[model samples]
Target: MGKQMTEMLKGTLEGIVLAILSVRPAYGYEITARLREQGFADIAEGTVYALLVRIERNGLVGVEKVPSEKGPPRKVYSLNVPGREYLEEFWTTWGFLADRLGQLKEEGK
Candidate 1:
């Protein structure tokens, strides 16, 4: 990815991960795979885990330990009420920024 994309992701990854959890509960590996499938090819697993830790610490998500066939147990995360609220705010903020940036791009064109 380009430097600009990388920089943008640094600010947006948390919201992106929250949006994913809002859709459904998933474990760390599942979240990473989903991000990759969604075109976040440059995202690292460590980055996602770190973001998960932060959100969990912030009380945005609830974690449950579920038995995994391939492992001892897997920690699955689901979006709590606070997480849903946060995601709504994220979308609103993202929309405003995107609209202003779009205007800038059009002006440049």
Candidate 2:
């Protein structure tokens, strides 16, 4: 990943994961794949798992262990009520930041 992209992702990765989960439940591997498919190709698999652990610890999401055909049970994650609320806040914050940045960019032009 480019330095700029990596720096940009630092603060936004959690919200990105939450946004993904908000759409549907997914396991760690699935989440990683989805992120990659969505253009976050540089995100590491372990990073997603670490975020999952943090969110689970913080009561933001719920987990279910489902049997996987290829291996052991997969721990699927879905957004909980708190997670939904958090995601809403994230969007609000993101929008505010984006608007401010756009204004600054326009001013610089």
Candidate 3:
């Protein structure tokens, strides 16, 4: 991907990660898989982990260790109360921004 593509996607990356976690609790790898399946293959794997740590630090999310049926323990992540609230705010703002951008494009055309 080019610089512009990265720049365009940057704003929504955190929200996308949070939105996925909202559906269910997930470990890091599981989150990566979900992102790939959702067509975010261009996202750097390290970036996801970094975001996870940041969100956790920000008190927006919580992590719990669950015994894995197969291998080692897994740290499962879920949205905390603050996370849900933030997501709701993000959704509202994103909707408004997207609509405004669409209107601007239409007018430009």
Candidate 4:
């Protein structure tokens, strides 16, 4: 994808990642695979990891090491109480912005 599109998509990456984790906890690679399968292939693999680190640092999510039978133990991430609260706030704000955008588009027509 071009730089502009990638930049545009960046803003939503955190929300998308958080939303996925909300359904179930997952490690980095699993999250990347799920995002690709769900049509977010344009997102670079590193971007997801970076976002995860940022979210964790922000105290919105927490991580724990889970032993893997086949390979090294993996760090699994899940939403914490703060994460759920942030997600709720994000949903409300996004919903309002989405409705306003739709109305503006209709008016422009």
Candidate 5:
């Protein structure tokens, strides 16, 4: 990703992750992998981990430690009620921005 896209992703990464969890519960690596599958190829695992920590601290996600065959227990995250509510708000805000930005882009052209 270019610097501008990277910067933009930073702003939206939290919502993106929450949106991912809204689909299903997943561990950190799985979340990162899903992001890659969705075209966020440049997102670092460490970035996702850090964001996970933040959201977990904020009580936006409910986590469970499940045994991992490869290493220590994995912390699988699920979107709780609060998380879902936040995700809904995120989508609303995103829609508002998208509409405005779309208008601006057309105006510029």
Candidate 6:
């Protein structure tokens, strides 16, 4: 993706990460891999780790340390109550924006 897509991703990435965690708890690398599988090839592992730290600090996620086979233990993050509420708000706002944009596009046609 280019600059514009990257910029847009910055605004919604937190909500996206929360949505990912709603399904299952995962660590930073796992989240990055999931994002890539979802077509977000430009999302870096470091970025996900930073976001995870932020959300953890904000009390949006519950974390547990799970020992890995090879490396150190990984901190698996799961969406908490506040995180789910935030995700709901994000989707509502996204739907509003999408509707407006769709109408604008249709008018331009």
Cα lDDT tens digits, model 6, 11-102, are 69998999999998899888999899999998888888999999999899999999999898999999999989988999999999999999
TM-score for each predicted model, relative to the true structure: 0.95, 0.95, 0.90, 0.88, 0.95, 0.95
lDDT of 2 by residue, 1-109 (tens): 7999988987699999999999999899999998899888889899999999999999999999999989878999999999999999999999999999999999998
lDDT per residue, candidate 4, 6-93, as tens digits?
8867667788788888998999989999988987777778888899999999998889999999898988999999998888888887
Worst 10 residues of 6 by lDDT: 2-11
Off by over 4 Å in 2: none
Q: Which pairs clash in model 3?
A: none
Structure candidate 6, residue pairs in collision: none
The 0-to-1 C-alpha lDDT of every candidate, in the order given, reads 0.92, 0.94, 0.88, 0.87, 0.93, 0.92
Q: Report residue 23 deviation for candidate 3 (angstroms).
A: 0.9
lDDT of 3 by residue, 1-109 (tens): 6788789777688898899889988988789888888777777888888999999999989999999988888889999999999999989989999999999999998
Query: Cα RMSD to native, each candidate?
Result: 1.0, 0.9, 1.5, 1.6, 0.9, 0.9
Which parts of model 5 have CA positions greater than 4 angstroms off?
none
Candidate 5 per-residue lDDT, tens place, 7-88, comes to 8986599999999899989999999999999999999999999999999999999999999899889999999999999999
Tell me the lDDT of model 2 at 93: 94
Q: Could you tell which candidate, 4 or 5, scores higher by TM-score?
A: 5
Cα RMSD for candidate 2?
A: 0.9
Please state the error at residue 18 of candidate 2 in Å: 0.5
